[model samples]
Each structure stands twice: as C-alpha cells, then as structure tokens.
Target chain A: MQISASKWLDIWQANRRLTRRVIEAFPEDQLFSFSIGGMRTFGDMIKELLAVEGPGIEEIVTGVRQKFDEHASYQTKHELLDKWDAETARIDKFWADLPSEKYLERVNLFGQYESSVIDAILYFVENEIHHRGQGFVYLRSLGIQPPFFWER
Target chain B: MQISASKWLDIWQANRRLTRRVIEAFPEDQLFSFSIGGMRTFGDMIKELLAVEGPGIEEIVTGVRQKFDEHASYQTKHELLDKWDAETARIDKFWADLPSEKYLERVNLFGQYESSVIDAILYFVENEIHHRGQGFVYLRSLGIQPPFFWER
Candidate 1:
C-alpha cells in the first residue's frame, strides 16, 4: 500500500508511536494480568511487538536466527517502552539504508516459502497493527482507557 | 505483487496453512511462555493474531475506530486454530462474494489510512507470513523442529 520507500518508514514510525502510547496507558499492575480468561496480558503483547523489530528483523536481514537472552527481564513499563523506542530507531536506520529494489527481491523467511522483501515489510506493519488492536481490547477489558487510535 | 484476486487468495491460503502447522508443532506448556527472555512464545503470538482479525477487518470496512472486542474471550490454541481455519474459509467466501470493482476501491482501515481492498488482502497474507517466521524461531530455540519451509 505504501508506494515509496520513505512511506514505509513513515508508517513504521507512526505504528511504533501508537503502540508505545497504548503500552504507556496501562498501569503497571495490569500489565501482566493474564486473568482475562485466555487472553495474553497487555504486557505480554508489548513484549512480543518489541522483540519483533530487534530479534525478528535481525534474523530477517542476516539470514540467521540470533540466540536471544532467554532470561532478559523488563521490570517496569519503562523498560518495555525503552526497548520499543530503541528498536524503532534501529528499524528506522535499517529502512533508510535499504535500497528500494531490495523490496522486490525474494528472501528466505525462516526457510519457508521465499517472500518478496516488500511483502515482508508490509507484513511487519500489518502484524503490529493487528497486535495493537488486541492491546486496545485488553486495555478496555481491564477498565483502562487506550490512547487515541488516530495518533499515528 | 499478485495481480489477480484469485492469485492473492491462493497465496493467503498457503500462508494461513503454514501458520497453522507451526502452531501445531509446539507443546502446550510454551504457548504462553514469555520466559524465553526476548521471545514471545507461540501461544501469545497466536492469540494476538486471532484477536486482531475482527477489529482489523472492521476497521477496513468502517471509517471509525469500532468498539474494541465487545465480545471476544481469550481463545485457547485449539480455539485459535479453529479460528484460523474459519477465517481462511471466510476470506475465500468473502472474496468470491465481491464484485470486480470492489478490489479497486479505496477503503478506510479504522481511520488509520486508506488502502485498496487488494492491498488490504495482501496485507493479511504478509502479516501471517511474518508471525509464522517468528514461530519458527521460537520452535528452534526450544530445540523443536519446525515444519518444512516448502512442504506446502
């Protein structure tokens, strides 16, 4: 949907900002509340999103799965937010350095069917949007107000 | 990009099946295991994916932020798999029901931005591929073997 390379970056940045705002809106105690029946807590969703930009993208670009710190802990909402901000910054640079033609080239995604780089990038944005919508529902179910959806 | 609507459906169906296989490959204990440090266990990621579909589609159909999850309980892995199967079926039916001109019309995705219906469909497939890639990484980290990348 985003035609230009710069447009992708813009969309990514907006998505990251929106996600961060939603994470910030939740109280610390509610972050890990997995008691919403079978739903993951808001904290859980944010962690998944944060990791996707760093470990997820790292694997995509390097063609190798990086061994992550299996015990890395985030004690506070700030820790998650910090990681979210840092990874977005890293992704912005990654996008800046990426050539537009690279988007059309197919890459081995986890040894699965080869997918074009453009489709992969779109996947990244769409995945975040999907999760962010979940975070909104979690927030409302917890009686917390989510950030304005259009801030992005 | 897949120019034909049927071509996009074919790809989307393939991507959904791959996700289903990856979800089936993991054990029950790790579904919610965020214990792997920076990684989101397969369970959490799958829930996020399932939770987003209704709202995401609602966004595409409506121009405003629809109420978030007025009626969704957190679904189990089996429940999620059932959803994945149902969505794939629903998508095929929805695609068949559409007129040719709807593919070219720009639709509002929850007021986030405007995207053509075709681009929106492409976005769905790409999102599944990205998360399935993460599932593979999680599987490998846990010393489990993922489904063959090209078995489909």
Candidate 2:
C-alpha cells in the first residue's frame, strides 16, 4: 500500500522529535570539537542541517537553485533550535496542503529523474539520523553519555 | 557553493562503508539485542534500511508503496551483507544518472508541495547516518567496541 500524505506527516513529527532530542543531548561546548577529522563535528552537522533545508525549500518554491556556503553564520545551539522549529513547522504546513496524487509524480532530484513525494519525506528523516549518529559517536568519544537511547 | 551531485554520491558510498563496517564488527548472535526498548535491534534496523530504500525508490518511481513484513529473508550476517551490496549498487546507478539541475525543482514528496531535489539527496545520506548512530549505541551496550571512528 502506498503511504498517504497523512502517514508521512506523522513520520515527520516523530522524526522531528527524535532529531531535536538528539541535538539537545550534547553540551554546547563540545558541539564544535573535532572528535574526528574530515567528518563534521556534531555542532557543525547540526548547523548544516539547519542551513540546508530552508534554503532548499526556498529553491523549490521559487524554482531557483542557490549556492549554500559552508561558512555561513549559524553559531549557536539556540539559533539552530529556533531554525529547526521553524523549518519543521513550515514543512509540516507544506505537507498538510499537498495533494495526495502528487506523491507518485516523478521529479528531478539532484539530477536524478526519480522521486515520489513520500520518498523525499522519508529521506528527510533518514538524513538527520545519519548525521546525528555521528554526534552520538562524538559524545561517546568525549566520555559524555548521550541522552538515554530511547529518548529519541 | 552548491554541492555537486557527485558529492552526495560520494558521501553515500562512504556512509554505506561505515555502516557495513559497524555491522561487521558486531558478534553475530548479539545483533538483535539492544539496551533500549523500542530501539531497533541492530539486525532489524539493517533489514529496515535495505527493505525500505529499494522499495521506497520503487515507490518514488512508480508511486506505489509496499508494506514491509516484519521479517526479512536474511537471518544471517552474510545474507544481510549480500542484500545491502545489491541494493547499494541499484541505488548508485539510479543516483549516478540524476540530472544536476533537478536539485532545485519542486516536486511532490509524499503529498507535500515538493521539496528541492537537493534536500532529498541530502536526506538520503543523512538518514543513513541517523540510524547508523543508533546502531552504534547498540554496539556499545553490548560492551563491544566498534571500528575506528574515522574509517569512513
């Protein structure tokens, strides 16, 4: 059975809760430490998450692709949290207003001609988990236990 | 700068490597245990990853999502590896062919108005990391140390 838009919204809500909880687990001081080289620090990844989605959404609505600079200012945990709340709310509204039939419509995704609306939504949740996983590792490396595992 | 599609592909390749290596490090019998209730068993999570992405991609393409049965055919680590490899190959090919401009296009994602293709691609990579992080906790709960953190 194809997942309907409403189910996708529920998933998004669950994911938002998980992601926010994960981000909040770390002490603000360690957010930027290089627990490992090459991979982004936990804080950097959080910043990246905040920076990317809104601009990406803007690009889609306007049909214009814009360059995202890595060094753009996203300095504080509070800012990231605020942005996360705003972006998720915006996304939720977007999903709520979406028509169900478009879920099957193919769209170009980063040069690939494959995407159902639901797949994109699933990816949104999945991507956060991937990076936050790194954050979890960072916490462990510092000998700071992350929030209880199921707290997500 | 806007990330090239190849950047995402490269990241995904690296992510798969990291995730698999994590799995490989686990003792076979302990794969299903976790300290957190409702925390997906490591094996169960891996199966979910495999089961979801391919069929999810198929759903994205054809607009028909399938309900996944609780048990996947692969009970052994080797079987899971095989499925993971095969599915990775499939996704790589589909992604490699993606047209770069579509990254900015709006398209329906699970009945949502449409997210930028770039966000979708980012979501794919990020989602993997998110779950893989959970897998890491499961590893630690077993008192089993994981591989070198930066191998990816």
TM-score of chain A of each: 0.84, 0.78
Give the Cα error of residue A88 in candidate 1, in Å.
0.6
Off by over 4 Å in 1: A62-65, A68-71, A104-115, B1-152
In model 2, the Cα lDDT at residue A96 comes to 54
Model 2 chain B: weakest 10-residue lDDT segment is: B56-65
Per-residue CA lDDT of model 1 for B23-78, tens digit only, reads 88877667666323343456766765665554555454443464433234544667
Clashing pairs in 1: B59-B110
- Model 2 misplaced regions, further than 4 Å: A57-70, A109-116, B1-152
Global lDDT of model 1: 0.63
DockQ of each: 0.06, 0.15
For each prediction in turn, the share of the native Cα contacts (below 8 Å between chains A and B) that it retains comes to 0.01, 0.29
Candidate 1 per-residue lDDT, tens place, A1-152, comes to 22456655676788788878988887888777633335456677667666555655555566676554423577688888888888887787666667665656787654553677766665666667656755655565566777775566
Over A54-130, each residue of candidate 2 has an lDDT whose tens digit, in order, gives: 54444434445545544556666787688789878877665555666555455454343245544444455656666
- Identify the CAPRI category of the predicted complex in candidate 2: incorrect
